[model samples]
Target: MSTQIVILAAGMGSRLGRSLPKSLTELSDGRTIMQQQFDNIHQAFGKDAKVTIVVGYKLEYIIDAFPEASFVYNEQYDQTNTSKSLMRALRASSSGGVLWMNGDVVFDPVALERAAKVVARDQSFVSVNTAKVSDEEVKYTTDAEGYIRELSKTVKGGLGEAVGINYVSSRDKAALVRQLARVDDQDYFERGIELAIEQNGLLVEPIDISDLYAVEVDFAEDLERANLLFS
Candidate 1:
């Protein structure tokens, strides 16, 4: 099955405190976060797939950096969240499976390969990384078998990190895009997944990407952690 990467890069990123979009933030290696994301995708998918990114908040910066990426502008980016951001990309894609990701999470190429392989089997897989994040970090709960059960806004006890990478089959991908279009309330993309799970009984085939240092730059402190992890 053909696969595509849809990146959510339209958030305000207020925590980063930078004028540039979070995805454009420079890493110690000189490559920006968006660059790393595309590089990793290229390494795993090669020339077989395309990279689609949802741009908002300084959209030009991200667009200029990755000229090849299929840009879908989220006009309501400042008003809404990731769910709306993701919907923009989903509508842009015509057909085939899609690998949806959040711009903040940086991952290794192997982690993506693992996610892709799982999706190859079911074509609807989402990864859960066993990160030791604080209780405030977003939590991803999995079923006993490792399939994603729910994505909780608040963490309870300790939960795994999502790593912001998920794969959806062509049918479900279209359904989800349509689902978001129907929803009157503006929720983030994670909420859309939950809705898919509830309404369509869609299951998430989960792969663990815990061992790698996949960083989510939510705040300035996260930036420090990322530097430590990457450097």
Candidate 2:
């Protein structure tokens, strides 16, 4: 099955206190987060893999930075969240499987390959990090069999952080679309996944990536940490 990579990059990233979009934030290596992500995807998937980036805040900057990537603009990005941006990408995608990611994260290429491998085998998967999880991170709990049972920021005593990468097989795409359509605009993309799992019995296995480096650049401190970890 062909895989499509959908990046949700439409948020303003107000917490980062940066004028530029979070995806455009420069790493210590001189490459922007978007550039590094593109390189990592190419490393894992190949140079010609299909990638679609959803843009809203500073759309022109993202467009100029990744001229070859197909973009879906979310004009109401300020009023919505990742769920809405992800819905747009899902609607635009025609591939049998999709690898979705939050644009603000930078991770090891090996982690990306591991996620891809899991998706290839299981058809649907969520990348989870067993590393130290802060209170602010998007946490999740898995079932006895290791599938995601619940996912949210407030899920206390959870297994680990989601690490902002998930794979959706075409088998589950329609259910996910319906669930996303029913969610509030402010809901996170994982909310839709949670609904699909609860209502439709969609199986999303969790792939542990404790050995890999992956950080979401939310605040300035996170950016510094990401630079140090990924550089």
Candidate 2 lDDT over 114-197, as tens digits, reads 877876764788898887767888889888877888988988898889999898888899889889889999999999999999
CA RMSD for every model?
A: 2.1, 1.1
Error of 1 at 80 (Å): 0.6
Highest-scoring model, lDDT: 2
Q: Which runs in model 1 stand beyond 4 Å of their true positions?
A: 131-133, 144-146, 155-159, 182-186
> What is the alpha-carbon lDDT for the whole of candidate 1?
0.77
Q: Each model's TM-score?
A: 0.90, 0.97
Candidate 2 local accuracy as lDDT? 0.89
Cα lDDT computed for each candidate against the true fold: 0.77, 0.89
